[model samples]
Target: MLNFQNKNFYQSLLNLSLYLFVYYYFVRVVYVYYKLAKYISLDFYRVALFVPAVIFITLAAYHYFKNIQQLKNNIYLNSFLSLFAIIVLSIIYHFIFRLDYMSDDVFSYQIKNLSYSILNALLGFYLYQQLNSNSSKKIIFVVWFFYAIMLLINLNGFALDTKGVSGVHLMLGDTFIIISIVAIFMNINHKILKIISLSAVLILAYLINSRSSFFSFLVVYLFFLYKEIGLKNLLYLFVLMFFVAFALYYFDLLRINKRMFGVFQGHSDGSLNERMEQFKYGIEAIKNNWFFGEFAGQAIVHTQGYRSGQMGAYMHNWLSYYRQFGLVFFVIFTLMFVYAGLFILKEWYLKNTPIKNMLYYLFVFEAVSLLVFRAYSFTHVWLVMVMLYSYIHDKNIKNLSEKA
Candidate 1:
């Protein structure tokens, strides 16, 4: 009995440590970005995030290895194989095109981006596994509390300096927090508390003025309400959306020429037109080098046509992966997305597990939002996609065997 108790205590400690580290990491990133809070350097922030992620990944890897027998029953092997193929192809594209040969900044940025992606992938997989383990409500509550703290910090930042936060940061941060809230709602079966919490989360999303967050909320809510509300309610929602679009157009909120919008529009004089020009240049660049495109490190400035003497540095297109690598790389990258989507749909139609269904919708919503609104090349989006794919693939195999 004493030994069992000690084992339980150790497990609890490990769980708590993981929770706290994740909470701190996410909250700090949100605070720094939204608050316009300064970090010493991108490298410094990367180290801060990467260290805790490495610790978490080590623990998770150990747990998986210890439970290797269970993995034999799962399709993790196939999922890992697919992931490896994608990485190998990416590496080939990197070296063959001499992608990082142009400048030190390009190589450094790519390294940091890759590091963040791997860390997020590991963290997301661990979280997904934990969700399937014990006491989900407690874990979710802890996560939500950290999310709330992060939201408060972001709001405080905006209140202090209206133009401080970038459009991309606002979109990404709010999307992450809102998704966490949605996950909690899905996992927790409490009707009243779930309604209350969800409403609060919606309000928070609205306050952030993140178009992506708003769209995600609409997508998730309508998906949940679709069958029950029938076509009439759907029509009403469509009408509402139409009016909102009209209002945005009338108010000049919707700018198609430039890939920018939101509160920061007024503060920066050249930002709107600059982004538009960058998008235009990106298209031209892609046209010129459609097959192999430019390397990742090329000095592809956005100020080519502008005689106004504005210094443009980075490619604002998150989809710039196509130009950075090539059409071949883009095709492979797209196939991964297609595979993930089809796998999720298959699981949803067959097994129909609540967790799987929620994840499916989340993946769809996030992918669409990324394409429509902002460019998050270095964010946790890819990692989240990988985790979702892995989970759905595993669950599908499990269901098939159970049926057999």
Candidate 2:
């Protein structure tokens, strides 16, 4: 019932997922070991990722060149325009509206993540080209198996209060994305398997008290499981929620209580005030470069009447990107999703087909995620883009083959 025309495409996607998993672990392992390598001169672990990364990049590049004509079709071409404009504008504002408080750490962070964004896009494009029906099942199986092992590692680390070997130092976000991806895949059947995975993850997410992950679980519930629930189920859900709240309170680990119970509690506590300050600072920082917004990790060329350090506070709010980065870049960001949506839209709605509905709903869920999380610089966004657009590629191949 998977309903895919190209098993090879699916396999490639699974491979990409595996690729991300390996890359992240490799980078983090190297970074961690490199730190303690002073005794043994193990710098090789530091740059070991470049070996596999370079090979995959080269393989992807070859495939990209082989499909240059098809790859540059109108859809990809238009999306590139959006990508190009955004990057160019980001660089321009970074230089033109320079902040004086830019630190070396911030500058390097931005540039490194930017480079990663391009590489992810290219790798995704390459994976998309290698679509075939005979794609390996082994890759998909491997990803799932690896995810199971990683999940255990994460859980163990959480229990022990130890930094995970999942590349905490270098690619924490990627690790989260990979976990979510594999979890989602494993739960595609949406029954006992789904419940088991969700329940385990939900407990872990709550035990760790990550509000974002908790919120993500809630959103996923609404997206995938809402329709199946009834009023009677709501009663059960409330009971479950009550227990969850009690457990969190009993354990004293829930960090977002202020945000959750500010009115009843009658006072601001914990991160609520700090989060508000960051959002406020982000909005104020954008005024420095009203058009293009503040540059990433760069000092404010001239920030008057504001503490220079305040401008650099961590931005946790989803809209902080729009508030801090500028409207033009926001529009460009919006275009990325829109372009992903435009692919093949199916000449017909093709009702009653599980495949069609799944893709449609996936995009809907994706669009909704923008309001909840900002992922403009994240490779996961590119991964989703490739996943969405591959349907278009399959459609194109089918149409051409029929004519032939």
Candidate 3:
């Protein structure tokens, strides 16, 4: 009886770990933390954001002390070393160069922001670890339940109070819910439950009306169907797309919106045009500081007197790394993402993991949509990328081990 109890306890812990990953990566856990912290005090936001970091640090220390044998594993050591190096380098560059924009220019405040970013990345890694665990189904279900609650709250007008309703949040949340539904379909044996789960997700996506997410879902769904339905059916999909485009065009919504379809049309007013102006200025800044570009946070300072409030803000372009960090750093950063993408693809193809293949396809669809929508940074793209890499890497390792 005692042994059985102990097994259940460990299983619960493992399940919680997996849920945390899905929660942290897809849901606005940080935003939720911020909302709760706001009632405590404005200062609490910083403390709240640091909570995950503090916990992760404690876990690392505990593992070092209690699991010394496991600590000696080269894979664990290398991941730590690489992560440490990246964090240190990014910090040095951000501070020495002043790479981000903040209302507070204090070094400690900047450190807090960097810590937040790193904490987010670590949370993403934790999620990856949990998702790959054997008991992932339980974890996925818990995450989905909490996610549904959050969605209900948001829909009912309980805004997170951190940032306003953003396209990024909507997209990431919808993606997670969609993926969770898919996982349920794969793992759950009940046919009726699977159909219900899928139907619920489809309804929820439509109700949300997140144009990018809705279109992305359609694209990926068609891709899946194409694989199942053959070339003749695929041609019909293209024809359908053409008619959809024509209808949207005939209505003048496409021209008036200036975005692909009408998905990004929510902020299509002058805001997008303003972003374009900012992008233009950002390009000019890049040209001017071509070598060791301006510090991260210094752009706001440089253009402080500009009439455009948004222009005197941290530019949204992911390419800002090039403008602020320099070509070398930007190249390295781009290479890292490219390597992650290729690694995901290679593993998916080699291992024939259907889940990983679906995830890779989703990421590819999202990446393309980002180019068209400029909504990547606002969403959980970084977390999603890390999760995809982790999923593919673990699947590949498992396959290789089985073969060996």
Q: Write the per-residue lDDT of candidate 3 for residues 266-311, one digit (tens) a residue.
A: 5454545655666776677778888666544323533455522122
What is the C-alpha local distance difference test score of each model? 0.56, 0.50, 0.52
Model 1: weakest 10-residue lDDT segment is 306-315
TM of each candidate vs. truth? 0.68, 0.68, 0.64
- Looking at model 3, report the run of 10 residues with the lowest lDDT sum: 156-165
Model 2 misplaced stretches (Cα beyond 4 Å):
1-17, 25-42, 92-99, 126-174, 183-190, 227-270, 297-314, 317-326, 338-370, 373-379, 392-404
Q: Output the number of the lDDT-best candidate.
A: 1
lDDT of 1 by residue, 1-404 (tens): 00123455446435644453355445455556555345466566656656666766676566656666666555544455455455456555664665322454555555556656555665555456556555654656666666666666656422322245455445444545545643564576664555456556655665555555665665665654453356787689779978987898799875332222443445453655555766776677789889876544124563445322122343554456676566765666666767787777777657545576567666666666556544434455655575676676666668888999
- Candidate 3: give its CA RMSD in angstroms: 6.9
Cα-lDDT of candidate 1: 0.56
C-alpha RMSD for every candidate: 6.9, 6.3, 6.9
Model 3 steric clash pairs: 21-127, 98-296, 98-297, 99-296, 99-297, 100-296, 100-297
Q: Number of backbone collisions per candidate, in order?
A: 0, 9, 7
Number of clashing pairs, model 2? 9
Looking at candidate 3, what is the lDDT of residue 404? Answer: 100
